[model samples]
Target chain A: MIGAGVLWWLSAPDDITRPYAADVTPDIQAGALVFAAGGCASCHAAPEAKGDAKLHLAGGLAFDSDFGTFYAPNISSDAAAGIGTWTLEDFARAVTKGVSPQGRHYYPAFPYTAYARMTPQDVADLHAYMATLPADATPSKPHDVGFPFNIRRSVGLWKFMFSDTRDVLTDAQTPQIARGRYLVEGLSHCGECHTPRNALGALDRNAWLSGAANPSGKGRIPGITPAQLDWSEADLIEYLTSGFTPDYDSAGGKMADVVANLAQLPEADRAAIAAYLKALP
Target chain B: MTGFTKTILGTGLCAALIASAGFAASHSSVTNKAVAARHAQMQMIGYHTGVLGAIAKGEMEYDSAMVDAAATNLRELAKLDGTTMWVAGTEQGATDGSRAKAEIWSDAAGFAQKFTDLENAASAMIGAADAAAVGAAMGGIGGSCKGCHQDYRGPKS
Candidate 1:
């Protein structure tokens, strides 16, 4: 029994395949909105890409943290330098499982733990939208981490401890809150940054979105769980859409990108997000 | 030996208390004024940016006059010399009630350049609003704000 269990643990599956229909047409327009809602441009766009040029996902932004500097890689459709040659199955695995086409483990900075909760249909739609973007040939940059953090295989252990493919809210009475949970817990990946992490770096799920110290050591990521945050649903919606607090202060810091993404979503979607936030325990 | 040591220690503690009272009196009142001024300046900037941002996001319909007025105010705010309002030692971790980082003082030139960029963006926005294209001009303004904020300010503590 012990030998059998060891083999099972050692041979954890590398891929969870979701087959693509050979000719199933995806809604490119809907996928475009999901791209914005996921805030891909805010991080993946070339640093100086302004105006409509922001659509180019050549990816060179560096996220400096206490762990080390993480450079966002090029996810463009250029075959030589990007994911152009990847199959739909490979893209789905990368997004949800944080695995590469070559069977390498991806750093959680990619936030697949949250993306794991995304519907496979949306993943296919997103793949369709990305196909239309202008693909640049910029090569990916290496991370600047040191010591144990650099080991890719160790990520599987971390994944085993923290990664969950389950929905954040399995039971919901209202459709609005349910939709909000999908966006927040999945595509938006708000909890990835907002929730505090354990000593081992996995999210302290108990704290949820109650905020934590920023990994950069420069500032704190303020708590947003209902216990610490008291914004009403209307105020929360306004904040999401306008980047303004009820006190008239404009949002600063990383939240600006989040607001920009939320601004693109419809008023009803924004309301749903607010409803979900308000309902969080 | 013990009596002498106790008397000296008692006198030393009393003198320390008086010295602290004097030090507290000297810094507290003066420090509050600069902090308050900085807060007021930020609020003024927020007031102008709030309206322009609302219009830019299509949350409110374009009213040329409101757009022009808010844009004008923000340009002027950007131009205002905040040297006095941003007095030294008013940063986060140094003191309460401020999120500005100490780096703002050390890198005054960098901060000034960001301010100039904001000024330039606002001026361009003013021209855009005049031509009924404030929406197009909003990106420059947002980018300018982000450029400075990414470096100088600490997190919302």
Candidate 2:
């Protein structure tokens, strides 16, 4: 029995293993669309005001915080400067496990908590798309973060406290509701902006979707609760489609860019997002 | 004699009716042209000031003197009665405009408030050519513009 158990454990596929070959067909292409709907570029790429087309995802974008300055790293596939040496498994592990190839923990600044719920297939598809991009060999800049944060190993404790390791699976609920849940928990990454963080930089689940001060300090990231905004599904859909609410108000700053991307998505997906946001507690 | 007399009378009536229609059409066309010209003038003023205000505020800084001249021209253009120029049915048809939102018509009062805010702020900037004061006024103008644009302008992807 002990020998059989060991053999089974050895043969069993791990969380990051692909059971089949990578799907690079149209379904994966559709997954790419879903990835865009999730707004990956908004944070990963350098910040520009509305409508400036530039791709600089070899991340040097800086964020100022009470703790210290954190610089996002180059995610390009360059072997030396970027993730070029990273295999599909390495990419999946980083996205789902929040651990780098060197066994170092990545800060939640990368939003891997939300990405943890992403389907392996979707993650693999994203990896495939990223691999096809031109490799930028820009050297990763060291984070200027101070004291406790500079100690990268400390992030393991942070992950233990905050990260959700479960993959999102659809229950026998209404399709619309399930879709909304998938989007909110996985791709949309609403909590990154909406949920308040504790002192240790972990999200306060009690204040989930309760709105938080904008990290950039420009303004408040508004609460999406039905109580706060009183927005109907139609209103939310229109806002997502045109960047204008039914009440004649429009989103600005980062949200404007979000809306622009959302507009490109199919109407049903936007509706699903609206449904999800409206159902939030 | 009876048929010939009736034919001549019918022709005369048709000619008179055509002449009257032509005269009315010409008159309406001229009126429309005038209204269009006035609307264009107001739009140009708004556009020019918007660009100039960006420069004055240091959000953008290009040729200062050229922007100053543009501001001056905007002030001259603003002399026209904007309310009258943007006639109800005609405003939607204006071109080279991405700033105007469909909500402008749906929520006229709110839209007017934003427009008034913009006009007042812009006029203040134009009145005081001092760079610092212009920057302050530019903030007000930018606020109003952004307030409206946020709600109305289509997303820029």
Q: Give the candidate number with the greatest TM-score.
A: 1
Candidate 2 global TM-score: 0.59
lDDT of 2: 0.61
The parts of candidate 1 lying over 4 Å away from their true place are A1-13, A18-24, B1-36, B47-76, B86-97, B101-152
Give native contacts recovered, as a fraction, per prediction: 0.36, 0.09
lDDT of each: 0.75, 0.61
The RMSD (Cα, Å) of candidate 1 is 13.1
Docking quality band of candidate 1, CAPRI definitions: incorrect
The local distance difference test score of model 1 is 0.75
Tens digit of per-residue lDDT, candidate 1, span B1-157:
3576446434543443443344334334334677767665665665566566656655455566666787888888888888788888788767765668777899899889988998888788774553238767866776676666656777865
Q: Mind giving the per-residue lDDT tens digits that candidate 2 earns over A56-166? A: 456677877766877878776677877777777788778876778776777778888888777766776777766655566667777778888887766765665567645
- For model 1, how does the per-residue alpha-carbon lDDT over A19-40 read when each residue is reduced to its tens digit? 6434556788888888888888
Give all candidate RMSDs, comma-separated.
13.1, 18.3
Cα deviation of A77, candidate 1, in Å: 1.5
